[model samples]
Target: MTGGRLSHLAPDAVLTAARRVMARCDELARVTADEGAITRVYLSPEHARVNRLAAEWMREVGLTTRQDAAGNQLGLLPAADRDAPVLMLGSHLDTVIDAGRFDGIVGVLMAIEVVRLLRVADGDGWRSPFPFGIEVAAFSDEEGTRFGKALLGSSAVAGDWDDAWWELEDSDGTSLREAYREFGLDPGRIGEAARRPDQLVGYLEAHIEQGPELDRRGESLAVVSSIASARRFQLVVEGEARHAGGTPYDMRRDALLGASEAALAVERICSGEHHIIGTVGQLEAFPGAVNVVPGEARFSLDLRGEFDGERDRVWNAISRELDAIMGRRHLRWRAREVHSAAAVFCAPLLQDVVRAGIRATVAGAEPATLFSPAGHDGMSIGALTDVGMLFLRNPDGISHHPAESVAGGDVALGIRALAEAVAHRGAERG
Candidate 1:
C-alpha cells in the first residue's frame, strides 16, 4: 500500500517495484561458490559479482558508484553542497551456507529502490530540497562465515580495523590478506573506508524480521527498538576415553555427556530470562567412533539478550552449571570468548521517524516495536552514527535456512515505509 502523499505511485506500481527488487535478489543469489547451494563468502568471486550487480543498479538510479577500499560497494547521491552531512542506507551482501535469498539481500535491494524513488522525483525538487547526501552501501561481509568474525566490512567503516585480522585464514587456507590482494583491494588502504561520525547525519537499514513477531502480530512492518547484545564462546570439555563396551557406567567420564548437560544448562538458564537466547550451534566429539567413549568435546556457544547485564547474568549462571556438571563427571572444561558486541539502541528521534513512516504506509496504524535478536550491519554502523532499523515480516520467521521467505505485499509496504521515512526525516531537517 502507498501512503497518501505518494498515492501518485499506486499499489500496483509499488508491487511492480517490489517484484523488481526480489527479482534482482534472486539473480544475485545465483552468484555462489556451491553449484547447488548459496555460499557467498567475503572477498570470494561470488562476492565480487554481487557487488558489481548492486553497483550497476545504484548507477541506474543516478548514484555515483564505487567499491570502497575494504571492498564495500557504495553508491552516492550527492547533495546540493559537496560537504553536506550524509545519510546512509544499506545492509551486507554476503550470505551463510545454504542461505535464503532475502536475509541480507532484501535490505540492499530496498535501499536501491529508495534511491530510485528519490531520483525519479529529483526533477520535482527532491534533489535541491535535501540537506544531506544519501548513500546506498552493500557491505561485503556480515556473516563472517569464512573467518569466524562478523562485521568485517562495517567494522572497517566504523574505524574498528585490526591489523591482526589479516592473519585469519579461511577453510581453504587462503589468508585474509591474500584474499584482499586477489580481489584487487590493498589491505593497507582499508582505513580509507573509515568515516568520521561528524560526516554522518544518521544511518537506517531495512531488513526482514528474521523472526515470527511481526507475522504473529499480523503487521507488515515494525520499527526496531534495539539490536541484541551477544557473546560467543568456544568451549572444550576434557574427560577420559575407554572402550564403550568395557567401561562401567560408574567408571566412565564421558566428555560428550558432560557437554550435553552443559548445553542443556545453557537452555535452562536462558529460558528463565526475558528476551534472552542461548544456542549450541555447533558440537563435535573427538574420535567420533561408535565403539569409543568420547574423550573430548568441543562446542560453540552463542548467547544473546536485549540488555548487556541480563545477558552476562545468564552466561554466569550457565558457567556455574557447567562447572558443577564437569565436577560430577570427573571432567574439566575451558571456554574462550571468540566474539562480543554491545547492544545498540535506536535513537529516539530516528525511531519516531520510522514510526511515522510505518503509520503513513499503513494509513495511521500504531506500528509495533521490537528488538532484533539477530545481528546486522547496524551493530557496527551504530559505532559511527545514530542507527535505526525497519523490519519487514517474514511469514515463517525462519532465517539462515533456505525456507526463509518474505511476502510480496510486505516488500511493497517496506519500500513505502523506508521511502516515507526518508521524506519525513528530510522535511524535519528542512
Candidate 2:
C-alpha cells in the first residue's frame, strides 16, 4: 500500500497515525486485561480510567465530546450536513475475561484513523465530503461478559436496546445499575441511549481473526460474510457417592463419564464443513475424598454454527448424546440454555468496499466470505443497518488471552484497507 490508491495521503502518514493510537491503547488494554472475570472487567476501575483517556483523546481530535446516558463515549466529527444520516465507525472497548489487547481495540483506533484520512481527503481541513456526518463511538459494554448481555451499547444505538439488561449482576452480586451510578451515569436514562432510527448511514467494525482460517489461508484480511449463531447450555450430571476403597468399580456410576460422553457428543454433532462445534469449557465436581465416588458434576456447553438450520441439527444431535450417556450411566441430569445468538449476514455493499480496500494491500483477496463463530457488536448493528467488518490475521488465531498476537505488517495492511473502504463509502454516498 503505497497510498497510490488513496492519492490523498502517503501510506506512511496514515500508518503512523494508526500505530501511534494503537501504542497508547495497548497500555490501557493491558490494564483492563488485568481483571479476571468477563463481566467484572467493566465494573472495575480499569474501565473507568480507559474511558477518561478516550474522552481526553476525543477532545484533542477537535470533536464535540458527550457521554450518552448509557455512558457510550461519543465523539462527533460533524460533517457539513447536519440533517442527513451520519456514518459511525467504531466497536466495543470492553474485553472478555482475561482478554487480549486487539479484539475491539483495532476497531476503535482504526475509526480514528478513518476520520483522519477522511479529513485529509476532504481537503486537508476539518471538513468532510459526504453529506452525512461521522462519529467514532467507543461502545461502553459490547462484551457483556459481566452483565450476561452482549452488544450493550451498540444495541441501544441500533434501537435494539433491551430493558432486560438492567437486572444484570456480577459474581459478587453488584448490579449494573450500581456500577453505572458510581460512574456518574444514571441508570434511569437508559432509554436515552437509543440512537435515532434513521440517524446512521451505516456502521463498520474491525476485529482480530480469533480463528485459524485467515492465517491458515495466508490471507491478511477477511471480509466477514456472516456471524454464526451461538447456543450455550449448563450441564449437571449426578452419580452415586461411595467410598473409593470399599466401592467396586462396576458398582459405582461415574458422573464424569456422563460429562465426558457429552463433551464427545458436541464434536460428533457437527462436521467441520458447516463450521459447527460444541465445547465444554468449564467443569466442576463435588466432595473431597480420595476414596469416595463423585456425587455431583457440572459443566458448560458452548455451541455455534454458520446457519440456524445447521445449528439446530447439531443441537438435536447433542441432545441425543445426552440421552444415551445419561441412560447408560444411570445418572439423573439437567441441561439449561444460557444464551443464544442468531447468525448475522454482513451488508454486501459494505463488504465490497472492504474488499476493494484489502485488494489495495494484498493479492488473493476474493470477494468471498467466512462465518464468525464468535459474536461481535457488528452482528447486532448489521440487523438494523448496513454494516461490514474486517479481520486482521491473528498470529496463532488466539484471543481472550494475553499471549494473543498479530503481525505488525498485517495490522498496517488492515489500516490501509480501512482507509480505502472509508474513502470508497464517502465517495459512493457523496
Candidate 3:
C-alpha cells in the first residue's frame, strides 16, 4: 500500500479520513423519523437533511454539487474538458425502518473520501490526469421503504422510470405523485434525472457485506461477482373456520397449520440447495383469536439466488411442496408473485479493477470474490452502464437493524481500495 499506491496520503491520514466517514454516518443515522430509531424514507424531511449534508461534504472535496430531479444528491468533479466521459461512485442514502448506520450510507461517504484522496494526489487541485471526471451520487431511495418499489432514484438515472410508479402509495395513503409534489419535485420531470449511457464509463459501489460470508472468510473487503436475483410471493391458504373446541382433530382443515408446514417445507428445501435462500418473512392468520381455528393463512415468500433460472427452480420446488401439503391437508391455496428482479452480473473488467484496487490497498490480503444477496442501486444502474461492487465485512452480518457495524480500519482500507479502483479504471480506459 506504500510507494505511491495511495499518492501522498499516508496511512495515518487515510485512517483519519475513514474516521470522519464513520462519524458522518453516525451523524446521518440520527436524522430519522423516529426519535429512538433510524427510519429515514424516500422524500421525507430527514432525507432532505441528509442530502444537504452530503452535498456540503462533496463541496468540501472540491466537487460541484446539486440534487437531481429525483432528489438524488450528486457531486460532480468535472473533467479537464466539459464533455469528457465520467465515472460514477455512490450508494443510496435512504434506509429501512430502524435501519443500521452502515448499510448504504457508508458507501456514499467512502465515495466522497475517495474524491478527497484524489484531490490530494493532484497536489490539492481538483484536476487529475485520469481523463474521466468522478461523480459521487447519494441516491435517495434504494430501500423502497416508502412506496414498496426499490431503486427509484437510480432507475431515473438509468432512464428506467415507470409512469405507473406515480400511483404507488405508502402506508399513510400518500401516493408517490403526492409525495413528489409535497417534496417540491414534479413527477412529470422525473425523466430529467435520466443519464445517457454514452455519457459515462461505469458505476462502482462499496457497501457492507450484509451477510456472513466476508466475516467467515476473515476478510475486511471482497469484490462482488454478481447481485442475486429475487422473487417475492404472497401465499394464501384457505380453510373453513370453526370453533377450536368444536373442530375435531381428524375432521379439521386448518389453514394455519398448513401454512406452518409449508413454511417449514420451504426452509427444508432451500437448506440443501447451494446459494438459494427462501424465507417466509411475513405470516398472518385470520381471526387472530386464540380460541378460533384459523380460516385463512397468508404469508410472504422471498426467494433469492445468484442466478435467475436457479432462483426460479427453487421457487418451483417450493410451489410443489405447498401443493402437496395443501392437498394432503384438504386446504385450498393461492400463490401470487408480487415482485421479481433478474440477476445482475458485475462486468468482468470492472471486477478485475476492483480486485486490483484491493491488492494495491491491502498489500498481502487476498480479496474474496462473493455474490451479493441484497439488492442495491447498482441493479438499476446496471441497465445503463457497467457496475462493479466492493463489500466491506460486517462482523455480525447484521443489517436493517441498529446493531449493524463496520470496523474503522476497514473503512480506511475501503476508501483506499475504492480510490485505487477509480485510478485503475482511469488507466484501463486510457
Candidate 4:
C-alpha cells in the first residue's frame, strides 16, 4: 500500500476523539510553578514527561515511537514500502505566557487522535488507505520560552545554524548552553537533528487562527496560502537636551518630534499595501526628567508583509520618512535592522488536500485561502521541507494573551482536515 490511500476519517468522529485526547493532555499541561491556565509551554522537565507519554500513546495505537536528540517526539508506523517516504503531521506544544487553553494544545493531540482512529479502523470499518503506516509528531521547543529565540528546534531540524544560535538566553539569563545541560540534551548533537530531505514527503501543521477571520464567518478551517515575513528595525533620534523653561521651541532640535513624524510616515505608507504593517512598539529616552528635554530618543520598528518586495517597500518608505524628519528637525538619526527573513508560501499540492478535507467535513462550508499576518513554526520548517498550515478559527481575532479561543466543532474540523492532508501524502508515497 502507498501513502496516498487515505481513508479519510469523518469530521465528527475526529472531533469527538480530539475532545477526549485534549482532556488527558490538559492534565499533563498544568503548570505547578504558575497554576494559571492550561497552555502548553515547553519546559525541559515537562518535555521529558511528554516524550515518554507520547511513546506510550504510540504503543497503545500500535505504532513504533521514539525521541530524537533535538527532543522531537515521533510515532511511526513503518511504511509497507520499506524505502517509502514518511508523511508527518505535527505542531509545537509550547505556548505564549498566560495563553488560552486551545492554542497549540489541540493541534498536537488532534494529530495523535486522528492517527489513532486510522490504525484502529474507527469501528465503522473506515480504514485509511495506508493503514499499514502513519506517523504523528510532537515537536519540542517551538515557543523558545526558556530562551528569547523563537522556532529553535525546527531550525535545527532544517540544518541551518550559526554561532549566534547558541548565544540565545531567557529573561533570567539562562543561555541555550545552560538550557541544554539542564534539560539533559547535548549542545554538540544539535547538528545531528537534521532530517533527510527525501525521507519527509511533506509536513502539515494544524494551528489556531489567532485571528477573527474564521469565527467572524462561522467557518472552521483556513487553508493558509503564504506566511508573512517580518522585517524588524530600530530608529534612533539624537537631539540636544536643554532646560524646558529656557529652551525655545524654535531653537530646539527635538528627537520626540522626529519620532512622531517618523511614526506618521509609517502610518501613511501602510495605506498603500493591504498586507503591510509597521509598528513602533517600544520607545526609550535617556536622562529623562520632568523639566529636561530628552537628549536621546529611540524606538523599535516592526514591519511585515506577504512578499519580500512589499516588506522592502515599507521599510524603504519608513527610512525615507525618517530622513525627511531628521532633515527638517536638524536632528541626527540612525536606522538599524535587527532581523530580516524572506516570506514563504505553503505547498499548493498539500493545500489542495486541506481544502478537500475541510469540504468533506463541513456541509456547504466554504474553505477560504487566507494569508497569516504572523509567522508559525511551520514557516521555519519551510527551509528544509514541503510544509502547509491549517488555521482554526479564533473567536476574538486576537492571540498571544488569555483572550484566544476556538469553537469545539471548528477545532475538530481542523483536525479532520489535517489528517486528510497527511493521509494524502502517505498515499502519494505508496
Q: Point out the worst 10-residue segment of candidate 3 by lDDT.
A: 1-10
- The better-scoring model by lDDT among 1 and 3 is 3
- Give the runs in model 3 whose Cα sits over 4 Å from its true position: 1-4, 120-125
lDDT tens string, model 1, 1-430?
2332444456776787899998987898899999888889999889999988998888887888899999999988878886888789999899999999898899999988887776534553334236788889899889999989899999999999999999999988999999999999999899999999988889999999989999898889999999999999999999988899999999999999999999988888888889999999999998889999999999999999999999998998898899899999999999999999999999997898888889878975689999999999999999999999999999979999888999888899999889888777776742
The per-model lDDT (C-alpha) reads: 0.89, 0.75, 0.90, 0.72
Sort all candidates by TM-score, best to worst. Answer: 1, 3, 2, 4
Tens-digit lDDT track of model 2 for 46-155: 66776777777766666666778776787877777657777787877788777777778777877776776666233443655566777888887777777767777777
Question: How much is the lDDT of residue 348 in candidate 3?
Answer: 95
Error of 1 at 354 (Å): 0.6
TM-score of 3: 0.96
Question: lDDT per residue, candidate 4, 1-430, as tens digits?
Answer: 1334344455567768767766755565574235676444444666677677767876676667777667788777655454666667777666666666566666777777777766644343223336244557777777655664567767777776565867777777777777777878888988887877777777788888867887778777788888889877777899988998899999987777778777778888886788897878778876678788877789888898988897897787777777887998889889887666678799988887777667655668478889987767676778877888888888878776766666666666666666666656555433
Give each model a TM-score: 0.96, 0.91, 0.96, 0.86
Per-residue lDDT, model 1, residue 77, is: 86
TM-score winner between 3 and 4, please give it.
Answer: 3
Cα error, candidate 4, residue 86 (Å): 1.4
lDDT (0-100) at residue 402 of candidate 1? 82
lDDT for model 2, please: 0.75
Tens digits of per-residue lDDT, candidate 3, 36-66, equal 9999999999999999999999999888898
